[model samples]
Target: MLRDIDPMGDQASIIGGVIEFIKEVQQVLQSLESKKQRKSLSPSPSPSTPKSLHLPAKPNPMGEVGACFNSSLADVEARISGSNVLLKIVCQQIPGQILKIVAVLEKFSFDVLHLNISRMEETVLYSFVIKIGLECQLSLEELATEVQQSFFSEPVFLNEI
Candidate 1:
């Protein structure tokens, strides 16, 4: 249901703001914990003060979430296997994107042998196995270039598989 909401709209902005706030809070908490540790190390704590009074430091999940948000989702990898070409792609979910991909494959005259699509949160991964007919004469490098250009607008990581 959350995916139904546009990421560029008000709800997305609100979520972004919340994530920013959580990051700030996590930073402050980490700094306070470090300062507490330093103070405890320098001055001798009184015997009456229980050593276990301070809570254990918890891992910061916000930092990991922020990193995930900041990183690019688009990626493309291709490999040759006998008469078939294996292609793996990761791109942000968008309307009409799948149709566009199918169109691109058609444009290059690739016969789809097998296709698998998986959606994870805001991104989608597409794994395609295709056969290049004798009519299609594009080289692997050229195919990579065309797919990189046609697949998504974001920076894509293209690698050989």
Candidate 2:
């Protein structure tokens, strides 16, 4: 199995590179946060005196905040009811990731009831209904967490029941 290879030679190097990349990303996030705090400490340069300079600025029609780009994974949703769990995932159009999700379910011993998939442009949406046996002995939270970690994205649950 890929997870079972000894982490000493080539695998070690790859793991090290990933760790270094994560550290770099964390540092960049921290730096951005510090810059944001610094900018919040001071007011912007005021315009020259005008007839009604003291009046407050008008609200923007668009929004109060600027636009931001998020490169994170698409959304994943899950819910459990009476020994059954349903998962809805929006992911990149990657076949391997979908397979990986199935593997995760198989690994955890869940019986899949239904698998539905749809695509729009570059994204794929998946809906899965799975049945969990009492013998599985895993809580809903644990199961949801496992799915999230396995997919490397947060899974939103709809009314945890």
Candidate 3:
């Protein structure tokens, strides 16, 4: 899970990971579609029929901020210079994701000195310049591993900077 897409690593591996993720998503969509089709085909239902589990759509609380979407999963790159760590993270533009990252940094005793966020159609790129705390004991590799595993259930690509 701590795999890094280093420049020196095989390019095929990265592509393979992306392809695998896409296939899984497609499968889930197809399953949902099939269920919808079956429900529509039945014009009337008896009392014994089980109620559909689908819930009514609700308005997005984030409004404009929640409209963005991304075609790919998350990617992160880490570079260390002296006591400072430079991080470049690209992921879906979801609310509270940045807070999760910040929480991890706090747990590791890293202080964010600067942050730059760029938003496109469906993705966000976060560039962070942070200072390593004097009491921090983890190495750069260990920090990368921790970040890689922080994302809830999505795969993360960690690249070397």
Candidate 2: C-alpha lDDT: 0.53
Per-residue lDDT tens digits of candidate 1, residues 1-161?
A: 43456655677676885685565455434434544565677674453432222122232343211001111223455567666876666656766666666667778898888887766556566677889977888765455555555544432232311
Q: Which residue runs does candidate 1 get wrong by more than 4 Å?
A: 1-73, 152-161
**Using lDDT as the measure, which candidate wins?**
3
User: Model 2 Cα displacement at 35 (Å)?
Assistant: 24
Model 3 alpha-carbon drift over 4 Å, by segment: 1-72, 153-161
TM-score of each: 0.48, 0.46, 0.49
Q: What 10-residue stretch in candidate 3 is worst by lDDT?
A: 63-72
Q: Itemize residue pairs with steric clashes in candidate 1.
A: none
Arranged by lDDT with the best first, the candidates are: 3, 1, 2
Residue-level lDDT of model 2, residues 1-161, one tens digit each, is 42356545577677885685565455444434543564487554332311111122222363321111112343444555445676766545654666667767777788889886766556666678898755677554455445545555333233421
RMSD of each: 19.9, 19.5, 17.2
TM accuracy, model 2 = 0.46
